[model samples]
Target: MLGGGGLVAANVYASATEGGWGGQSGPDATGQVKSAGMATIDCPDVGSRLTNVPDGARADVDRALAELDRQTASAYQQLQASAQALSADPHAADDSVMNPLKDKRSATIERIAVAIDRVGDRPEGLESLAACALLPGQEATGGVTGGTGQPTATASASPGGGQGQGGAGQAGAGQGGNGPVASDYADITAVQPNAPQPAQQADASRGSFTSDCGVNANGLRNSDNVIVAPGVSNGAHHFHDYVGNQSNNAFASDDDLAKADTSCVDKGDRSTYYWPVLRLQNGKQERDAGAPGGGTEGNAGQIVTPKQVTLTFVGNPRSKVTGMPRLLRIITGDAKAFVNGPANANASWSCTGYEDRQLKDKYPLCPSGSDVVRTFHFQSCWDGRNTDSANHRTHVAFEGPDGSCPEGFRAIPQLVQRIVYDVPAPSVEDGGRTVPLFAVDSFPEQLHKPVTDHGDFINVFDESLMRQMVDCINSGRTCGAGGDGGASASPSAGTGTGSGATAEPTAGASGTPAPSASNPSELPRTDATTTPAHTTKHSAPGEQDGRGEQGTDDTGRRTKQGGRSGHGAQATPAGAGTSHSAAPSASQAGEIGQAAQSPEPGSGRTTPPPAQSEPQAVHGGLAETGANLWPAGLGTLLALSGLVMLIRAKRLRY
Candidate 1:
């Protein structure tokens, strides 16, 4: 049964015990081996039966049970690993001979059954091991029918490990004489089509830009600006599918990044677009996961070739937007989305050719000429405050069904990611498969589950390309003539060439506005003014802002966006400081000067401190202005006005 056999806690990276405070079992809870339910890894739940056996008998039982414990944990590791694969992309459980889900489960049950025979006469160690064969609650238990929550077994079975006396004989897959294994996802249909099924809805006022980022078939990339995760040991821990900026990494500065090679049709667009590496886990474990002293998690599988990768941003039709600055990381779809409720989960899985078939855990076998796709809708309405949140969420939220945001939440360009995989058409032999689906490289503790498989993006786009994306979505035109934001109709990468991959770039791709001129009727205004109010600093695309590339200061050469704050290494600490400091050069000074006076697009009024990044106490002795000097003109006006008033009343006052 697919019961919750989670080996670790929710925060796998936090502590050795994972996340729980549950203490170890002792003479008190004699029979029960409970966990803190918070993810404590140090619990002796398997051998509670050996608690009180006689001293002479205890040592042998302990030795035999120790080996049993080792075997069970090993099986559990493989089970969790396979489960993680299935979770990320449900179709991984194909019924092929290479790796079948049922075979794994069957082997695990047999291993425990053999271990129990070793315990022989020791009833304590023998009894508890039987219970675990159930995988706790009912789910992955498969063939064993009837009854629920942990399997009930009889220790009365013979010492030799033959089929146990009565009916519990199915314990060993060896005894059942079953012809073939089965799948947990076999003939299961649960996910429903979204209310609107993500129909074609384009806010003419909210423009959209769709970039056809090239399809990459193999190998992990480590570029200048495409840093996937920083704290993960300086980024050697994982690898993602990068397509936009050639120079993308954790430490790549925006300036060096802008000139890198781009896989997108728009040669100038330097935005680094990436997601988890979708692996084709056959037998070969391709990419390295930084082993020995660096990192333990590595991915060994064939990389799936994407037929089409469309990157798009559609602004809420009702808001006026300008441009997003550098170093913005956006995430959508919860890797833990298997849990119910939209409050924290939004992972959607569907086949490109089959909209009616939506499953939370599995994808349908695509017919010939079709592919698998994962669609993600990022929170569009922002707080007009922080660029990044504590959990990398929070600061932004999804729109209501009516496409409106709650008060205080201003709308930004809604970002949408669609990656299409050229998976092979399902064959009859591919049913009941397990652990064959691929995912991007990540830590092992994450279980590589699709529910925890989320996408990440850092906007390193050249000023013109980013501005075009922001403006297109803001203006409400659906760009991307060569591609639709969703339904990918492009040629396959490194393989087939069916969907017109050879077509030239569209006019929008040429940096020209699309549908805005023909249809400009905007959506209902959310506020008194249609223009969105920004709370962070806005910079023209490519221009060096407070936090991007650094400039030479009076003191010495220092980092521009991320300064050497002696506080702590964590960027964007709560109530601490932002990634940038006071102005370092004339361009940044002019940014404060000129942008402060310009209004947000469509506002029709002078701007009020064009939205700045998350608010942090300004550090560094440098001032926003060139020298922080008062305007001489304003000072002279104040002096003249006071002198005029004095002269007019001087004679009469005396």
Candidate 2:
């Protein structure tokens, strides 16, 4: 009980101080590369769209950015001076120093924060900036620092290797994201299929292709690591998810991904899918992995996994479907729906068992037995020969009720991706209000801005798998990852003749698979969006590994209790506790296992949702670590905490 008490205290304190910018310096090499990024500040393309903007608004934006630039430079200079002082005398805070560096850094961030607020008023301008890869745009190139104001990139994902590892990728560029099926979404005693009804997917003249990639937690959170289009410059500030190649990065080439291993069970399937990572805001936190400790402000625990991941490509209702080209990444749900008001709320939102109860509220909770979920269904109609459009989405359109491609659009495999998260029930049993959860990223700085959440994908499916998927759906066979998701590939499959040309080109003229994890393009409203976790260089105050006494890197990737994660470190988000501790509440224990396991797609019968549990013990940390922008500590702790916060803040900025 005493040992348990200590563990509980650590978690509570950690939870209280999970997020916020830390004031520490980032890794030297990574920092230098990100800082030296070649992007310049200027949105010339945005100026072209000025007519759509209000008169003189362009100047306002310029002024605001200039202010950001000016403040940033001053703060940086001051920060350097403070660092020099610290070098001469390590005293920080009361001991012998005031940590002028932290002060200046905070001031700079505050000024930038204000500038961001003013610019946020102009949504169109931001979008254009994102689309055009203007100032600080990342696109394929990593972003510029605006002169060292941006936070350093967090620790890189470690090389994949661990227990329960499984992932599907294009070919064999890299190993699958590590960690085997430690848990499933729910209890499997009563498991069954979760596919749409036959009529919902079938039309006499169309065909489809589909795969079931399990939940992903390793995709990079950086927006600059473009995984879709080829050789595009910094064109976006928004964040997205990526998959397939483990080493896939902003500079990854097509050949790199083609050699990557698959994360799914189907080795032949080489497609990559990604979506926005979600965060629970009702308060969850941990302290071991470099995250701060102690705060009354509820916790923002570990980054969460989507409950489910489903990928499908179908044809327009009236036309025969063609096999898709290799590197076609598309978006389905409207991230902007959560922001920019109701007009853009076209993306689907709902819980598992509460299907009838579609969610209009941002971050709605799931019913007692259901999971938090989001679904993205791409267009089925395509322009016969082209794989993309200038804007990225217009080339593909959905089929109407009649099952026909309206005009020039011919049928291609339509894609539908459904991602689910095993969110636990709220603490207040009596109340029915949904606690707010959010997804934070490097862009848009406005925490909890719903529009910032988005999903994307780059289909690198080998043509054989593509044709097989097409054959499976056209023939009315319900199949998945080489298994019977709803039904087996029909004995009489290949019933319908295919659309498009019979001969598939050798991916590109270079004779490689199309662009994928190594090559992805941004599609404005139409796209989807992977990363692994790594240990950090810094350790938090009173931090320990899962073994209790062993030290940890405090990077939030590995926990003291051995509950590790790459994205926010492996653990439940929002109201939950760490996965490292062996003794989770009865309900939490179940959640840990469920979240670790991949949800199986079956006919109406699927894994049964775990029974809801009452709120467990309400414990708090014994030793508190303050989360204030300006930390209060006895010299050393202050420097450490403040430094960590600065790192957290800037690294997470978009």
lDDT of candidates 1 onward, in order: 0.37, 0.34
**Per-residue lDDT of model 2, residues 222-322, tens digit only:** 33334332333222233344444443445556677677765544555556565554543322432211211111111123455443444545444444566
> How do all models score by TM-score?
0.45, 0.44
Q: Model 1, 122: alpha-carbon shift in Å? A: 52
User: Candidate 2 has what TM-score?
Assistant: 0.44
* Model 2 root-mean-square deviation: 20.6
Per-residue lDDT for 570-644 in model 1, tens only?
A: 122121122211112111112110211211223221101111121222311258332432343344455566666
Candidate 2 has an lDDT of: 0.34
